[model samples]
Target: MPWKNQSGGPWGSGPKGPWGSGPQPAGPRPPDLEDLLRRGQDRLQQLMPGGHLSGFGIGLVALVIIVIWLFSGVFRVQSEELGIVLRFGKYVRDAQPGLNYHLPYPIETVLLPKALRVNTTSIGMTLVEDPARGNRTIMRDVPEESLMLTGDENIVDVDFTVLWRIKPNGAADYLFNIQNPEGTVKAVAESAMREVIGHSDIQPILTGARTATEQAVQQLMQKTLDHYGSGVLIQQVQMQKVNPPSQVIEAFNDVQNAKIDYERLQNEAQTYANRVVPDAKGRAAKIVQEAEGYKQQAVAEAKGQSARFLKVYDEYVKAKNVTRERIYLETMERILGHSQKLMVDGPAGQGVVPYLPLNELTPHRQTPATTGSARQSSGVTK
Candidate 1:
């Protein structure tokens, strides 16, 4: 009806053609002109042929067909991948990596996404490289979009990375659910990381909490993606450098140095205690040992002196007169003989004089037996 003339009839066939005789049958057939031409080309080649023209023609046609088929459903999935099939714009089945067949395109189509490869997302206020960043000169500086805030209302520079991979099934179709997956992941990571960072201090973020932050971001990203029904599996989150904004970098650096000094002082005190405590113990032990040795030596010496004095005292108790006479004579002798007068007559001659006390010149006037008895009584028997 669309190809018909506006008169609602075939062009000039109203009276003689389809409407006239309902279409007439052919009376005679045409000659085999195509067959004759084919025979002529074959005979010409047989006489002086340059190359396999027929084979080349056949190969060209076959090549075109092969190319069409190759681009049609001949999808090549990696060893770890799977192909998702769609029929009439609807999901049909999943195919593995290898030679596979499907109904030609428009009827049954194939969609593929790397099922084993990891995907990544990023978040933060710290400047990073981006394809969309302006000219090379501008890109050399911070990317303003990456800056974010902490819960304490402090602007901190934080950079991070996310690692993920598409789930095995329906990944190809899942891609259609989002316009820009990278951007979505970035926003979610930034939100989650910022929320966590806000609850922490700048020092922990810089030095200690990198691992926790990375894991938290990874989990948060996974949760967000799951909430959005995005079939993505998070592998890891890498927490990069976290620093104070450029305006306060110097202050933060000074704070770091102060902490180092604090630690240094603490270590010095510890070292002093460590050295002094052991030395004090050793000195205390040495003093105690010396005191113990002195105690033993003094006790032994006192014992010997006491024994000798007891022996002498016992002897004096037995012969009191003899001991008294001997002690008096020895004392007098030593006192009288302490200094002798020396008279000098001339330079070549000297004389000594005895300086004794001549108070008692009387000897004992008694019998010999009585004298012996008296000497014996006075302990002078020997």
Candidate 2:
């Protein structure tokens, strides 16, 4: 609202202003600086009861204000915290954990951050575990972060968690070097995971190679953060879930089952072969041994007979007449031994008659003798 005087002119140019010289305004006028100061002094003297503003009164007021201003600079840093001090918006020094002091606000300040606390960055999924629910976890998937490509040009879903903490001696860098430490850690974690996954096949990621993958990601994240001077130490990498995309899970299962079946069949066949091959080889060796033995026996017998025949031939060559007579006698003796003989002697002009032994010709005895047997048929001669 615009102020006006009695003559209806504006207050700045009116004939009576607040000073009662411009236009003679009747209502309460705005107090001047000097009037307000005098009134404040009067009120202070009245409130003091028996005291007045002597020589030391103003000095005491200044001393109390100074004490409060100095005390305002005092602060305590907890055991787990690292205090970063800044003077006039410029970094001064790092304060140790304990009671510490600095210049009052606007001149120096302190930033206390928990340097020993372990922080976690979860990629792909966030898990909320409920203690009342028997420690069951509820997961919220972040598909944009989780989906990754594998080395074999396959899509896989990877859920992992990165455990990290600010370096104890590097807290200053952690606080001042990076604008957002948590965001940097998370971005590095996601990038490291992707790089590892991109170099690996889907089969190993989904199966027994998950541990190796986690370690690789952790190492890569540590290297990357170290390079960027992030002052974050990666403690561990934990893989929660590694699997094929949902759309291809059924197909992947079917392929895995087929591979298992094929391997089983190959193992069974190899087992059967392992059982039969040795036996067959053993039987073959036995047969060959028996044939060799028979061949040796036949050769030994043939050699013995040839040696005996050669000795007999040498004796026959030494005494031909005596040997011929002796052989004839032995032949006759062998011939007459197994047969019953009847002699019939005739005159010199008549031919010799052979005698037959009808009594010896029995059914049971009517058998042919082998050439080498000691039995023979006989004929009589003059």
Q: Give the Å shift of residue 373 in candidate 2.
A: 23
Q: What is the C-alpha RMSD of each candidate to the true structure, in Å?
A: 18.5, 15.7
lDDT tens readout by residue for model 1, 226-300:
888667777888865577777888987898899999999999999999999999999999999999999999999
Please, what are the lDDT tens digits per residue for candidate 2 over residues 225-328? 88888788999999988887888889988998999999999999999999999999999999999999999999999999999778868878999888789878
How much is 139 displaced in model 1, in angstroms? Answer: 4.5
Instruction: Provide TM-scores for the models.
Output: 0.55, 0.69
Report the CA-based lDDT of candidate 1 relative to the real structure: 0.62
On TM-score, the candidate that comes out on top is 2
**In candidate 2, where is summed lDDT lowest over 10 consecutive residues?**
12-21
* lDDT, each prediction: 0.62, 0.73
